[model samples]
Target: MSRNHAVLTALAFLASVLLPAAASAKDSSYGFDTDRDRFGWAIMSGGNSTTSDVEDQEALDKLKEEYGGDDFLFLREGDDRYVIRDRALIERAQRAVKPVNEAGRELGEAVSEQVHLALGTSKDARERARLGRSIGRLSREIARAARRGDDTEDLERDRDKLQRQLDDMEESSRDQRVTVREKTKTKTRSEEASRHLKQATHHLQDTMHDILHDAKARHLAEPMR
Candidate 1:
């Protein structure tokens, strides 16, 4: 063959040798880009980090069999950050929101029960005083939870205000008890004590209602479901 023809033939042989490898690399690089395949990739990557290469590849193959098809893309955007073309982040955010929302709901219910207990029965001054003290303790718990940012700031403020109201109710109950004791023989003293008891009960109910409302609002704003 002429020198030019020989050179051209050698170039053709080199091209044939290198082209398949280049094509294979390109195919491997863009392999998968679907949700199921991406999930499999994540599982495989996790398993491989701890297991032998044989075990890792076996796990990956099993996942591929269970899921079928390589149609997913596992894109690592940053450290501990991954992008799934699925609703993974939304599902994660929902999971995180659940417990906090449930806590708010439970707190609201407890506050409501305390309110009902305080208001449902008419009691003597001393009994009312005890109920008011209980209500005050519940309010403090609610305030602490709110301050910890488990709920809203408005919730914390409402709890603090309710605590103050409960404190006032307790003091009023004690005063009514003292006044009744001082005038035990008087006929009007019984009526006066009843009036004070009713007032304390009403105050307790109102404070509890405020606390429940605040909690419900916070819960509704960020529902677990």
Candidate 2:
């Protein structure tokens, strides 16, 4: 009933097969094709064997919450004694969104620094769209400072800082756009991969279902937007 119960069952055999010479050797991570630990997959080669499951409701609830998806699915070959979960898809989804999230963090830091500089000085007009302007706007700001008989040094310093951050923010936006596109693309690929897995099961005369009676393995990572 535990998450690793089925995996441990298969893994014990794997350990024996992979390390027949070494008894009591610690388990090391292994990779074949795309699947890793918890990223459920069965390979055609002897490297990986198929897994099976009946739905475990508590596990399914937890998976839905973690992934924010009701559409989480798996393939069960009819009576094959192994069910394949979508952990790989969840992992890919999270990775797809990572670039955008990192870019957002950088943009926030830059904007925060620029905001502080703007607030500490005389640019009350900074509330408007003045902060993310062109270098020409910086010139106007310097000229205006001279007319106000104010020292232009502070304004120039802040202008430089704001300009650099503005550039960073723009770049971040572009990166986010690209990452979102990638998320969509990856989602499609994941669906295709799942279909292929289903086909593999079908060839073995196993049945595929959107809902399994008791899915023991649940995909628990959230999808990235």
Candidate 3:
């Protein structure tokens, strides 16, 4: 019934509530999967394939005739004329959304840090509350960067709710209890950030897939080899 003992008890209760959310953020379900890792695509060429400008130009003309413009690249190695998706475009898309992925990881880390603070009896309550606000800020930043000119209403709403929760945490005088309550909502915040990250990754993946699908439809690219 001592003051320190009472505080320790409340902290333990809060840690238990927030720990699962923290663990979920740290898992592989996080939004850090890069485009290359998600795609696992390889150029269709053989061992005897040797690069030739003459054959490449000829192949390019053929591809242009079929697929219109530079959407697909024609690679001529030896007798193997393989058509592949434009990797430069995919790389460019990945670069554009790189900030989203980084922010996702940072958001997860921040959630984990807040949970860690809650579990420690010596940790500061106000520090944990500040981290809660940080998580909200991260969510909004990810949502903005991930949208890529599209209207992300659902994502925007999630980020807005998170920001509001952070505002509540900031204004609360009971830092210890409020911080714990806010950390409990880390699940929602982590999920919002993750959803944005996945959207960004899918955007790049879809771009690559669209070109691949096009080539397949035109019989320029073969899935088997």
C-alpha root-mean-square deviation, each candidate: 32.0, 23.6, 14.0
Write model 1 residue lDDT over 1-225, tens digit each, in one string: 233443343344333322222133212111111222212122222122111012124433554465365322122212222212233332332333334333333333344333332331223433443443344344434323332223334544654465455445544553333233322232133223323333332343233234334434544211111
Give every collision pair in model 3: 50-78
What lDDT tens digits, residue by residue, belong to model 2 across residues 1-225?
232442343334323323312123321111211211223222111122212221323343344465453334423233233323455542332343233223323333333323222221223323222443233244334433332234557766765676555444434442222234443353344234323333333322211222222334353322222
How do all the candidates rank in terms of lDDT, highest first?
A: 3, 2, 1
- Stretches of candidate 2 above 4 Å error? 1-84, 121-225
Write down the lDDT that model 1 would get: 0.32
Candidate 3: regions farther than 4 A off: 1-87, 96-100, 122-188, 214-224
Better of 2 and 3 by lDDT: 3
- CA lDDT of every candidate: 0.32, 0.33, 0.43
lDDT of 2: 0.33
Lowest lDDT 10-residue stretch of candidate 2: 27-36
Error (Å) of candidate 3 at residue 201 is 4.0
